[model samples]
Target chain A: METLSSLAVPTVLILAGLVMARGKNAFDAFLRGGAEGMRTTFSLIPSLTALICALSMLRASGAAELLTELTSPVLSVLGIPPEVIPLAITRPVSGSASTAAFSALLEETGPDSLAALCAAILMGSSDTLIYVMGMYFSRTHVKKARRAVVIGAVGAVMCLFLSAALARIFFRDAA
Target chain B: MIGKCFFWICSVSMVCSVITGNTSKLASAVFDGCADSIELSLSLLGMMCLWCGVIEVFRDAGFVGALARRLSFILKRLFPDCADDSDIMGDIASSVAANMLGVSSAATPFALSAMEKLDKRNGCGDTASDDMVTLSLLGCSSVSLFPTTVVTLRYAAGSESPYAVLVPVLICSVICTSFAMLLSRLTAKNKPLGKEKRKSLGKRKERL
Candidate 1:
């Protein structure tokens, strides 16, 4: 896996080589592309700022924790292990919160346990659904993104159940 | 919808903070959040530009068009509206490839480019087309081939078989992506409250 990521540099060099072989100015193309990226980055900053502020306030005010605790009972009824509930709840809202919850889960459940396996898989399979929605939709002038959010949330929930089921099947002997 | 949700989140947090007597903490968080976002964007800008530049080189060399043509078999089904447009499909192809490879930094630039192209294609420029929703949906439910960060975390935590969850993660991601796509497609028929319709309705009311 590490080797695969390491290949990224070489892949870029190869593309650059291919461009140069065509007798065109790869550097000039690169500079223009970079300028385009700068524009995209600037456009994204406003929404990202608002989103991060709201989410951080949610966290700092302890509302996020309250919400998670409120949802845990319903989650438990769905067969989610109590140990992984916090991770699942925080997974879509904030990436850093979920990572913290994940490490906490490993600490509490032991890394080789079924709950830990489930948490790991859940983290791996899912992205920050709400954050992605905010970032992507910021690019367009769309005012209505409710349906997109609903669909993304559904996908996140699907990942949650699928992760638990797969973990239980593959790690039957795990503690 | 996003605006409403943002408003609700902020208001809810403020109310919760007052109730919990953590108003000071919430106040601090507001500034901290702004600072953090700028820091994040700064960190992201480097790799974002690099990947965009790299992809540009490929685009200049005509490699993107060839790759798009090759991937259109699958891309066509996912983005029927963009199937005939090599330019849009090419951007979408790069975005999807970067996502699958778990290079999210690389993916965002391409994804942004694709979103811009899709927005232009939609013509409305104000309302998000079905294709735009689907593209954003695709980014959210990432079907990564190698979830690098998760595996590394597991290994760091001393798991005996850090890679044991890889297959299951892959399976879960695939299932999630397909299900989301199906839902998006099903919901695609209904147009959102488009500006054109609203404008026409307002004119009709004014004449009345």
Candidate 2:
């Protein structure tokens, strides 16, 4: 599994090499494209800076914990384990933060625990909504992302519920 | 809209921290966050440069067009509003292909490029178009064939069966993606371009 996952980049490189070999002015095109990418990256800095600052503030202020605790009642009713609440709250906003939360959950509950399994599934099945939103909109200079953010959040919440349900069904006997 | 949200969250959090007397912690977090964002953007710059270059080669060799042609049937269905010969279609195809393969770092450039193409087609000035919203939604929903990072983490954490979550991840991802597509289609406000408009846009693209 590890070998297969690591092969994605090599496969892409090989394919790109084959295609470039057949193309005219491949080097020039590559350089131009890289320059364009650099421009996009330059434009991304402001938005990324703002969003990350806000995220850091939220984390440091313990707002994320507060939000998680506030939502735990509803999540518990939905069969989500208490240990996974922080993961759910942070998953959309920050990838690294949620991964940290997930690792903490695993360490606290042991990797084989049902909560750990559910956390893994939730983490795997959802993208970082806010991060993607920031990157995409910043690149395109789109001012209105409410619709995209709302829809993405809805999908993440739906996935969370589904992950918990599936974990219950699959890991019931083990637990 | 998102910018306001970020500002609001930052202010609210800052106020709360002040009220809670965590001023020192808040100050440190602000500096650390700025530093972290810069580091992340720099790393992303390298990855984007590499993949964008490769994508350019693919475009130069007409591989993207060929791939788009092969996948046009599904692409047309997913993005019916986008024209058949639009370069955006090829970009979208490449982005989705990279995403499903679980190489998100490689996927970012294609996704960003696709959004730019969609923005051009929409002619919305600075606002997001319906297709852009849909594409963004699609990008956010995890559609990877293998949840590689999650599995690796589980294994490192000493799980005996790290692959145990694979099936559930696949099922949930499919559900989330389908739901997002459905919602986006239902709520999309931008009307499809007229036939003449599409033709003119295609001509403009060709002239470029």
Candidate 3:
């Protein structure tokens, strides 16, 4: 599965090339499309810069850690492990940051631990919603993504709660 | 609105850092963040260009159209306005498929292309349309049948069963995606009415 997933992009490229053979102006079309993609990428620079900067500053300022500490009490009341609070907070904003936090959790509490398992489940089940929203909205030049952002946040919260609950159910014995 | 929120949060964080005597750390973070964002965008550029080129080939060869036709039934229900726009539909289908396979890097380009096409179809408005919101929802809560990243991380961490979280992850993803869909549907009807209504009312009063 790992090999196949890694090869998926190359496979699609090959197939696309084969399909392009039937067309007379494949090269021109490809270049045209590539140019369009570049344009989109360039347009995304401002929004991406703002968002990534904000997120990074939020992380580096220790605000994220403080927020996690503040939320841990509320989260524990809902049966969530205090350990996974950082992962929950970071997962939606930055992918690499959350992955690092997840790795730290696994190291702190063995991989077999309930906290590690919950972290794994939460990471897999949800996505970096803010990042995705920023990219998509910027690419499309959509200024008002208020609704999409709200909905994505709600979905992320659902994923967090459900993952924690399911982890408790499934890893009860392991913990 | 989202941009403003980010700005305020960022400002607040900077203020807190300064007050807490973390000025040096904050300065480094700003520089590092700028550099990181540039690197990230460049990497995204490479992937987007590659996939866009390939997809263009598919489009020229009619494969995209064929794929769109194949998935039209479901796509129609999900994005009714895009029923005739096979290019957009094809991009959406490919994006969702790649996401399901856990090839998220590949999915990004497709999703962006689909959003671009959807925006064009919606007359390039500044605000996102309902279809755009739905697509964003799907992208954010993408249901991955094979979460290779998590499994690999678990293996590296020396788990007895790296794939043990598979079932729970899948179930959780389904629930999350469903909730996203439901929320999108419920909110679709409640378009921001404040500015539009005030403007229209002012026009009506002036005419009267």
Report the lDDT tens digits of candidate 2 across residue range A1-175: 4344346557868987776676668878888877877777778678767767676777688765676687779778878887787678778887655655565566557887888888888998898898888888877767877888888888888988898898888778546
Q: What residue runs in model 2 are displaced by over 4 Å at the alpha carbon?
A: A1-72, B1-71, B190-208
Q: For candidate 1, write residues A78-158 as lDDT tens digits.
A: 766657776787688776556555755675578888889999889998988888888887787777878888898888888
Estimate TM-scores for all models.
0.63, 0.64, 0.63
Candidate 2's displacement at residue B73, Å, is: 2.6
The TM-scores that each candidate's chain B achieves against the reference are: 0.60, 0.59, 0.58
The alpha-carbon interface RMSD of model 1 comes to: 7.4
Task: Please report the candidate that would top lDDT against the real structure.
Answer: 1
Please provide, for model 3 over B1-208, each residue's C-alpha lDDT reduced to its tens digit, 9 standing for 90 to 100: 4456466758978987876666678767777767766765565576567656766666566654455456567656666556557788778987876677554656789999999888887789888998899999899888877665576567666788777787788889988887887777667753433567457657968999
**Which stretches in model 1 have alpha-carbon errors above 4 Å?**
A1-74, B1-70, B190-208
Error of 1 at B121 (Å): 1.7
Assess each model's interface with DockQ, reporting 2 decimals per model.
0.41, 0.39, 0.40
Q: For model 3, state the Cα shift of residue B183 in Å.
A: 1.2
Candidate 3 residue spans exceeding 4 A from truth? A1-70, B1-72, B190-208
Report the C-alpha displacement of residue B115, candidate 1, in angstroms. 0.5
Candidate 1 vs. true structure, TM-score: 0.63
Error of 1 at B207 (Å): 42
lDDT of 2 at B108: 83
